[model samples]
Target: MNNPAAPPSLLPANRRIVLSGEDALRILREIEFLLMSLNNIGRHYYPDGDDDGADAERRAQYCAETTRFIDAQQATTRLALMRRILSAQFDTTLGDDEMDDIERAVAALPLWRVPGQ
Candidate 1:
């Protein structure tokens, strides 16, 4: 016997939980807000270093902390609800590149902070 063909959304719909566009946008916005806050704080507390090495280290530290924060928050239903709120908040659709930018920003934050201190 031959297997029946599934609908287009069947694969994704079956495998993963569905999140509304508004939900995803809220999460993205929360991430953006957090990063912005960190940038503002870093600008004030973290000095503008003269050398590239010092700058790189500080950014790395920030990124590491941000990554940890995201991982910690991922387990909560509140994050999901907040993302749903953000979905209505944003006017534009978020692409993979945009999501990637968030990751890069997180990774680069350590450039300004001290490492393993």
Candidate 2:
């Protein structure tokens, strides 16, 4: 007896959000790294080095010209959200050594002060 060929199958359409504590920690760490990099970029562009009136004005204009991607309000809001999520969802002891190092970096960030510390 001849067997018929199987029909082609369609791809699955359903998606799931499988976020765990570790995933949350990694996300928070990435946000910390992003903020740190942005701060460094800002300092590089807007230096307090000695400059005359015209030079300072030129540098100011240059800084504005160069820094088009930075969104201060968005960064602030994201950082706040990251902090809140990390505190609420994840425990500090649940991470590995790499996360430990990232946690230290996150702690040292000067923008957000730890409460009751």
Candidate 3:
């Protein structure tokens, strides 16, 4: 599995990528779908019942996975909103100060790891 702390090689610091509104919507939809799927899978594997200690480990694992997914979903949603606001209010290419602000905003978002990663 890739390290979650590592920056993506595809996006270098000096590179700037533009995402259209449609792209942002698609990303949001995909994240929602994945979250739904994660919930479904967790339910199938760990149905709610009396906590009999037998399933304690599995339940904890499921809970952790759910937390990660929810965190990622929230951060992604915030990012999409920020992108939309920036696009609507200013040029696609941001100046250094604007970029710094964006970087800070992104850094404030929760960092999440994928399940089984």
> How does each model score on lDDT?
0.51, 0.53, 0.58
Question: Per-residue alpha-carbon lDDT of model 2 for 41-109, expressed as tens digits?
Answer: 555655664334336766776567445534643655666776665455433442344353225445434
Q: Give per-model TM-scores.
A: 0.31, 0.33, 0.36
lDDT of 3 by residue, 12-103 (tens): 43345566788767667666686677768577556774346536778777777777866866756755665665445433344445454345
Query: In candidate 3, which residue ranges exceed 4 Å CA deviation?
Result: 1-21, 49-99, 108-117
**Which pairs in model 2 have colliding backbones?**
none
Candidate 1 lDDT by residue in tens digits, 1-117: 534343222222233455677666767777676677556545543667332545676768766766665566553455566655634333343334554322333443424457766
RMSD of each: 14.4, 17.9, 11.0
Please count the clashing residue pairs in each candidate, in the order shown.
Answer: 20, 0, 0
Provide the lowest-lDDT 10-residue window in model 2. 7-16
How many pairs in model 2 have backbone atoms within 3 A of each other, for residues 3 or more apart or on separate chains, i.e. clashes? 0
Q: Would you list the clashing residue pairs of candidate 3?
A: none
Question: Candidate 1: which stretches are off by over 4 Å?
Answer: 1-17, 49-117
lDDT of 1: 0.51
